[model samples]
Target chain A: MTDIRADIHAQTGASEPGFGDYVTLLKPRVMSLVVFTALVGLLVAPVALHPIEALAAVIFIALGAGASGALNMWWDADIDQVMRRTARRPIPAGKVEPGEALGLGLALSGIAVIMLGLATNLLAAGLLAFTIFFYAVIYSMWLKRATPQNIVIGGAAGAFPPMIGWAAVTGSVGIEAWLMFALIFMWTPPHFWALALFMKEDYSNARVPMLTVTHGRRSTRRHILAYTVLLVPVALAAGFTSIGGPVYLAAALVMNALFLHGAWAIWRRDEARAEADGYRTEKQVFRLSLYYLFVHFSALLVEAALRGTGAYALVGIAG
Target chain B: MSTRTTPLRPTHELHKRRFSRNLGVGLTLVAFIALVFGLTIAKVQGGGTLQAYDHTFRPALLPQDD
Candidate 1:
């Protein structure tokens, strides 16, 4: 026990971390995506919210997302230290103590849930609380180390933000909200799989059961193509929903075609070719996936804007 | 008994910085929480214009005009 404590203490350096390190522990990059998607969900809803109430809801939701990040970092610090991509994270870098992270996470979780409940509605608050628990306890603790399907099942936590946002505005979940959730859920696998293909060594060293580590690269490649094909229909289908407009349809069509091409390129590559080219196709697809989600969400926002200006009515797509 | 002088421990600046920053963060969070709670209370009381804000905040909570 003393040896283990010493090891942990060493990993969490004796030097005190600055404010920025604490922010890093919150996984700001991931939080940004959560914030954007949640905002889109809230804005695209038919109901309008007071500016202050909307601001509070978004802040609380962002805090809930950050809370999940801190807890995940606290729990995964050991493996994080072993993975090259994660080794420099605040906890693994010895900048923040694991205990501090856990405390911050729990505190923020409580505050976010209660505040969101007060600011929005009980339903939105409940969803936020569930999302935090799902990510921190279910995904981080249970699934991450247990199975190769971790990303597949765990993607639900990330997918909940937009649903929660919709709930915040409308005080209920709807088919449209579920469609947005499904979009993220389906996008996660191919996106993470692409990263895994390029960073298989990190997962191998950390002994995490990522698909690329458990199954061979060939299998992982095929999985990406399969998920991408499934994702295309969902993306296109969303363009026909109430939120859908010509802008979204055009964006979805072009993006899905490019996404399919990227996945196909990846599927056709062998380990030898991939290694020779430094996993270029896989890396390109991974980057494209980021833009893919952002563009889709942005198109939704554009449709919302057009609706606000009555252009959607004139276009007869305001349903 | 022979007396030996112990070296003075050096003060770490990083610790001081972290302490102040964390304090600031703690206070900010507390203030935000207080504000949210206050808004909630005002909402529950049906406080004038604020009640309209609450009504719009959750339209499902209000009676809908079919």
Candidate 2:
């Protein structure tokens, strides 16, 4: 890492991240969630969008999410350098200047909002703009350094993709859209806190004061289990919505059971045993959490297909 | 000669220009959103009125039963 940093310094008199480096600045994993949730929103909304417009809107929203990621990297560069998990990120690696990242983020934000408005409706475009600002300014700048409850609040930034997607199609928000947002919002804490349980040292090293750092590992573990308990019902409830079906219900049921079991095991394990387990339990839980989300969303698309084929009826029972 | 620190004139002007530019852009964004909202309201209201008239007068417009 040091050699790479030295090479970067030798090549450029000043650290100016290149185009590819800028692309890396937009964390691709986070971008994937934005893309997936937004796709689900577009797919399940009652209002049908023309294919071209839908495609354009989704792409622009993804770009807007990416803009937020870049802004986050720019702002967090200092602390990111200290975090082992984030030290290799472009800005932290000294390949990019903070100002450059800020500029890129702002430019992309403008392009995305304008393009989405042109391709779809102004309502969706406005929502996308707000989402970008919410993440870049509200969550990244304000919430992160100020409080350990950062992830809980900042999680909303990640939840906006589906809302933006729904707005793109319907040009309005609804209960169903909020339900989807709620699912992701509730799921974020458990997913992140589990990782934090196993990697407490990283947070300590970075001085970021993550939940595990502020509280104890046991508290973080209990929080993970608690959130997982809450997550299961929400995940399953989504299955009964207008967009859900037998396939999704089944997937949610099985995935949530497995997730709950994993969280339970993590919470119950002895500290020495957990350390001896070599992050296996937490890693497995994290991986399962990834699949859990994808499967649920995929099931929604499957249900849509079934309805389109006249194989199944779309129905919403009274709540 | 005595060295004295004075505020940079160009820097002050740059900040002022930036401030004005941001203000203009922000206002433009707000106006655009308001216009769009107005248009959406108009479309929905027009659609509703049209639907109501169509439903109410459909029988009158049809050929009479013998």
Candidate 3:
């Protein structure tokens, strides 16, 4: 730990972070996903919101996601420096100080929660607060290092966006909201496990108990296949909900077929074969997983748009 | 006898630029907070009249009343 601190000090001696570095600290990619899912939740809700209120709700939810990202980076600075993929992140790369990251995160968290409550409702704001705390304190600080089930339970933090968005509009959670949450929650393990398979050494070096590090690659592969199988039902079931439509069902069928095929391909590959191919199948599955979630949500958005235009009325499935 | 030369100091212009940047950031944050507060108040008091502020900042897609 001392060596890590010394390494950080050496790298950051006189470095001055640019505005972009501060933005990087917020994990913009993760924030984008959060914002998109939350927006879908808000738009798909049965209730109506004024344009300004919807916009404000999305913005505050985004800020809360950013705050969680910053706090995660701050808490995981040590392991971050060890991981090859994360070594160049703001704090680890010495672009931003840990203290600055913490302060920014705390400030953003407070602002997002307060403003969300004012803009939407107390339920949404409260959920946003819990999401931040769960990600930062529970997942990042505790679960991440403690168990192989880290991503399993920690996935809840990422799963809350749509629920919060639903709450923003309806001031309560519903089955559809939980279904959206469930889709992401189920997707996280296989998605992360694929990355972990390829980046085994990083988790090993960081001593983080990612399933890959603890249970070995063979078990991780089985887990990936299992979770992907489990995820299919959730993903398919969502397409039958009020938010679901022909577009969503079509997309779900095609995407789930490809997703399952990819998972099965990984499940069949031995460690030696994976190593021989540089974990290509695992990496492909991981990439597909990203599109899988995005397309699912996008299909929901399309369903909502179709309903907006009375197109679903033709099919008589307009709820 | 000390023989090491001291490093050149940053120029006054650099200091001024830094100060100005800091001031800009500070002001931006303050303005943003004020905007959020003002909008929240207007939202609570005005009910569904968010369209009134549309001229100031219009959303790309407006929600329609059914």
Highest-scoring model, DockQ: 1
TM-score of each: 0.86, 0.78, 0.85
Candidate 1 ranges with C-alpha deviation above 4 Å: A1-14, B1-12, B19-23, B30-66
lDDT of 3 by residue, A1-319 (tens): 1444345446555456656677888899999999999999999998778777888899899999999999999999999999999999999998789999999999999999998998889999999999999999999999999999999999999999999999999999989999999999999999999999998799999999989889888999999999999999999998888888789999999999999999999999999999899989999999999999999999999989899878768778755
How far is A86's C-alpha from truth in model 1 (Å)? 1.0
- In terms of docking quality, model 3 is incorrect
In what order do the candidates fall by TM-score, top score first? 1, 3, 2
**Which 10 consecutive residues of model 1 chain A have the lowest summed lDDT?**
A1-10
Each candidate's DockQ score against the native complex? 0.24, 0.03, 0.10
Candidate 2: list runs displaced more than 4 Å.
Answer: A1-11, A14-16, A313-319, B1-66
Q: Which candidate's TM-score is highest?
A: 1
Error of 3 at A234 (Å): 0.7
Candidate 2 local distance difference test against the native: 0.79
Clashes of each: 1, 0, 0
Which has the better DockQ: candidate 1, or candidate 3?
1
Clashing pairs in 3: none
Which candidate model has the greater DockQ, 2 or 3? 3
Assess candidate 3 and give its TM-score to the true structure. 0.85
